[model samples]
Target chain A: MIWDWGFALEILPVLARAAVISIEATLIGFALAASLGLVLAVVRIAVPWTSWTISVLVELIRSTPLLIQIFFLYFVFPKFGVVLDAFTAGVLAIGIHYAAYCSEVYRAGFDNIHRGQWEASIALNLSSWTTFRDIIIPQAIPPIVPALGNYLVALFKETPLLSAIAVMELMQTAKIIGSETFRYTEPITLVGLFFLAMSLVSAALIRSLEGLLNRRTTR
Target chain B: MGIRTLVAMLVIALVVIGALATQESYQVFMPGLLQGAVLTIEIAVLGSLLAIVMGVLAALARMYGPTPLRWLATVYVEIFRGTSALVQLFWLFFVLPQFGVTINAFVVAVLALGLNVGAYGSECVRGAILSVARGQWEACTALNMSRPQMLRRIILPQAFVAMIPPWGNLFIELLKSTALVSLITLSDLAFKAQQMNQNTFKTIPIFTLVLLMYLAMSLVVTIGMRLLERRASLGLARGKAA
Candidate 1:
């Protein structure tokens, strides 16, 4: 009836195990998003021919909800003979959805590079790939680190949506515990606390990373 | 591509999709989805209004309230912002009943979403207010205006222009979040799509329709906010001159 400390203590291990799955989803999903986003951003800028389509695709993904996107992948792709397990579908959905956003951040980072930098790279007769690798990305990525870090936190929070397709992430695990034991207060409250603590930790880490980057750049 | 070419192509694509959706097969799902869209829009509208009010109040409290009030506002903003919206919704929907508080699902959806978005909105509000030049506040004080009077006539009008774009963003985020309310059994657009999919197993058409509907709503919000930003900036110039 009331908050039970014993029950809360008992479920801590279960929640911790589930939290690892959620963490795995977040890390993998974020890595996918960050890389895919960089590729999307570079394609839009470097290859003039593909810019419009890429831009529209990014817009469509960014505008739609991630929940529906996950459903589309998990549910609809089977009709096209490309069925994916729930975890895969959920990870792909989150990665693609946030890639749209992360691409914009990358684009903004790229835009901050002076026009002279590109012209200089061209004047030096450097290949586009070499220019992007040696000149553009190194300068662009540092500033956007904080923004990407925030998305890492965001993706972690979103792993619970995987539970909609039965991925057994933290929230879903907690929900099951609630259903079986009929005491949601402990598990759900613990889930909330886990999210809060993780996000705060990530936020602090991001701040330190920002400071470190600033020091290196300035030096 | 040229803007004209892009618009023309987009319109053509929509027409093609629209014609296909008119077939009897797809028509069966429309009424249910439309009903859900209506509820989604309703929740988004109500949630946005509540978010704005809470945001402004919290920002003001954090900035100008006494120490205790500021601390309370800080905790509210941090706790709400730090946790997931779905968790907030579930805690409200499932856990509160144990505490003898049984809110209707709709109320819980709006409240959970409004409070969640409001936490982020407060930061936007705070930033906008802080960006209002210190000179403006001093000028208001020089004219012997009270804090509330200064905020009403001078500070807010200026900060409002800055707030519109971020508020627009928060509103769209709120709209996307309404999809989560379906999990609580409110049957909003996303919920309706999943329900229809379960029954008919027509996942592709159903999800495509729902995604497009969501895209259309977000586009409308985007355009509306852009127009409002333009109007606000125009007013901002007049305010600045005065």
Candidate 2:
């Protein structure tokens, strides 16, 4: 494959702009997932009555493909009077999709919190909310930071699925460039490199965060 | 029954009723979706088989082969694992043609899925092998066993057990990922769903049905993997007993 420097230079600015949208989608979607996942995990643990429903909902979300979920939100939801623009629907779909996975990570962290910690909180007569806030979550979250970071990287790679709904993400921009120039190598390869760089950087960050957390726990 | 079980049952019943209520649409769309579903299964099965082969070879090369081979394996794993699968698929489908290599869509799907999942699967293989314990290697050496013999007879059998669950996950992930092939104009389940939606304008039922179809396929893969895992672990238990 021939590498065209001039073509690459021309497309760099457009691809960079699209990359910003991709990064924003990943960050926003991840934020939504983190909070929603925590809520799901907490509700499942705290309310016995809702645990079954929540678990089923999580499983259904996890089992289905994210593309279908995005399409359902973008296309089907409009018929149901819940119209969403491509970016909003894409982010919401991604957020909800990853929320299922994130909740499982949160659940694992919650499960790792020792029973004695809970009983000790009871002995101290702390409110349940206070117990979770003070005793459980602090210990639980540190270990899961690495796992959560994985989903962040995964979510970043998956942002291209938004292009299916016509969100002007990096992948879509590359496709447009390819169609216009009829030269696929440079634009697609650049997008791939962008993803690889982000993934490696995120992984390194997660590793250092894990090390920091471990040192604090040991100290 | 527990209240939890009752709630789950009620949800299942509602889904069943909803599915059945759309019997007419099901008749119209079922044939196309079923055809697409078959293609999806074909892609998953063929892709996973290719992935397992690539994973084993790459893992071996990375762990014990020459430095150049090790670097090759590492690069393959990192590049595939880091990038978007859609980009890879597009690269193969769109870009390869420019290089005077035009593979059909199905072959492109299989190659992309296999290579992508193989990248992830190699890690599972490498991890399982490394976890087989240092003493086992020493013992094999002490017995004057060759590297291949030791790996095939002692190491891989045990590692196979450990690999099953993660491989199961990879298989399901691969199955879900096959949906992306639809974007490349492969007429897979997702493509058929899109086509049906365009024709019928029954967006909710059409997409819902396709979603359920995918879920059903994933469930099947999961159940099959569980059975395979049980068989592998059973052999492990039997080996220990003997």
Candidate 3:
């Protein structure tokens, strides 16, 4: 196929414009995943039955493929009277999927708390809430910054899943432009390049965050 | 918490799912759910097989290849690991078709998934191999075994055992990722679910069924993997347990 530099250059604006949607989906999805994950982690930390049930749900979500979940959500939820829009469905699917992963991150955060912290809290006549808020969370949250950042990076990549639900994300924009121009090489190459650029920047940012966290921990 | 006591609760959960599934127009949803489940399996299996092969190749290149080859492998790993899988799939299926290399959706989906997961799995493979200890390599050389012979006889068996657990974890991940392939229009579980949802307009019932089916399929595979892990861990010391 003859490569069209001009065509690829033209699509750059279009793809970049659509990138906003992808970023939006990612942010919304991450927000949902973060909150849901924290809720489940808190429940798991507090109640055995809640934890067990949540574990089963997490396992189920984790085991099955993500594309399938997206499909189920986009295609099936309206039947029971919850008619979600493409964007909502996409965000919800991404949120639920990543929440499973984030829960593991949060659970790890929980696990990293020294046993003595809990014992000390009990010894001090602290309530469970006080123990968690004043002691456990402060200790547990720092190490998790890097892991949660990685998940955020992952969530950004996964925004293209929103394309399956017909959201006009970055990749979907590329596909449409490519088909419209009948010049795939340029647009496709640009997409790869675009993703590469984004990933590199995000990775560097995560590393810096890691460094910052490390410095804080040492102090 | 007792076996008989919890049985009622477990039954209730199943009943709830079933009840939710059928309290609306649902017959069409079952076929779609089953279809999506099958597609999910096919994509997961094919993608995972590709991932294993690519992973091993990638690990080897990273481990033993010439400088440039190792560099190339590193580039591949970093790019894939850093990006979202959905973008990769869209690029492969839709973007490539515009370039006049119109591959089938299934192939595109599988290749995309394979390459994506392979990048991650390569790390697992490398870690597993490295964990095999420098002592083993030293021991093999001390026995004066040929390099290839030593690798086959002394190192690979242990490495293979270590590879299985990591491979299983990657497989579970790959299974979940196969849903992205539906964007390419393959009649996988995700595609079927979407189709049925569109036709029936009973989205909740249909999707709920799909979720249950996926959970069931993944649960079975996970349990199977656990059993394999057990068998590998115990080895032929079966009679010791017996």
Candidate 4:
């Protein structure tokens, strides 16, 4: 079939509308992963018993595919008499799946801290809390900002998996439009373009955020 | 809480959720999860094998091939790195159908994943090779080893150990990406979960089991990789390190 600019133009608005859902899911998932990851990292390192449990939890989460995990949360919770909407389930699954990865990132950060930092803390008679907060974390984060930024991009791209469970995210929306018109080209193409554009924007935003954080850390 | 108590609580919660929930009938879900697990492995192993070869070749090309070949490899690496795998998946599956050559979903997935990993693996291979010191190459030359023999006997052995760990991670990612194959009606874990969701209307148990199956497979892969890594690294890891 010849490329149809007319069909593509007509589908742009619908794709744009669906882009909103994808963007929203990414935002909320990012926030959740960020916070939950911190909680996991702190518990794993601070309390020995807590670390043991957290390690198991982290391993369990990390070992599985996020798509399957999303399916689990989407399918299973309803049996416990807690029925989540498709959108809530999708986003929760994505966020929960990613929290595991982010925790590992934070843990990797801590691991990179040389033993000398701990020695300095002891020599200075500083509490572990003060040492970690003031000295160790500051030094650890800069080198890892780029990697962390990469995960955020990964999390954003994964929003499409939410569509499998009927979340009406960009891809799902495009699929519906494609079916209605029998014009898969227009909707799917636009959806791909939308994802490409948004992800590029996200990469730029993360870079700026990394730059700002680095500047603040240096000062 | 103690670690035991915490795990007990989570297990209890999962059990309760599994018990009281009115998920789909077990029969439909059970067979499907098992079959999907098998398919997941098939795609992962085969695709990873493809990726390893392509990755090594691309790495070698960039390091020693003609200028144009090196440039082509570089562009391939950067473009794949810059884009999301999901986009790559869709393009391979959906876009290819428009060209009147609709390969099976499994092949599409294998190709997309292999190509993507190949890009990432090239860097690992290149890095591993670079880490092989000039002294080793010189020693090989002194021993009257040809270029190919030097690579096979001296340089590659050192580089291979370094390649193992990252390749393991990439393999896990490959396994996970295989779930996307369910979208093309491939009867994989994700696909089976979808079918169970459709037939039983019991989303949770079916999916939880599917998730566990994935976790189990991934654990096996991870543990196996670690063991191999330990063995590989035991003697200066004499081969590839990436």
TM-score of chain B of each: 0.91, 0.89, 0.84, 0.83
What DockQ do the predictions score, one after another? 0.71, 0.66, 0.51, 0.39
- Between prediction 1 and prediction 4, the one with superior TM-score is 1
Model 3 chain B — which ten-residue stretch has the worst lDDT? B1-10
DockQ of 2: 0.66
Which lDDT tens digits does candidate 2 get at residues B123-214?
Answer: 99999999887998999999999999999999998899899989988998899999999999999999999888888898877787788777
Compared with the true structure, the alpha-carbon lDDT of candidate 4 equals: 0.78
Ranking by lDDT: 1, 2, 4, 3
**Best candidate according to DockQ:** 1
TM-score of each: 0.96, 0.94, 0.87, 0.83
Q: TM-score of A-chain in each prediction?
A: 0.98, 0.97, 0.95, 0.86
Estimate the TM-score for candidate 4.
0.83
Candidate 3 residue spans exceeding 4 A from truth: A71-83, A215-219, B1-36, B97-100, B144-147, B235-242
Instruction: Give the alpha-carbon lDDT of every model.
Output: 0.90, 0.89, 0.78, 0.78
Residue-by-residue lDDT tens digits, candidate 4, A1-219: 745898888778877788888889988998899779877886777677888778778877776788777777767787888889988998898888888888889888889889888788889999867877898778777767777777888898888888788888888887787678766666666666666666568778888988887788678
Candidate closer to the true structure by lDDT (higher is better), 1 or 3: 1
Kindly list the per-residue Cα lDDT of model 1 for residues A1-219, writing each as its tens digit: 489999999999999999999998998899999999999999888899999899878878877788989999999999999989999999999999989889999999999999999999999999999999999999999999998998888888888889889998999999999999999999999999999998889889999999999999899
- Judging by DockQ, tell me the better candidate of 2 and 3: 2
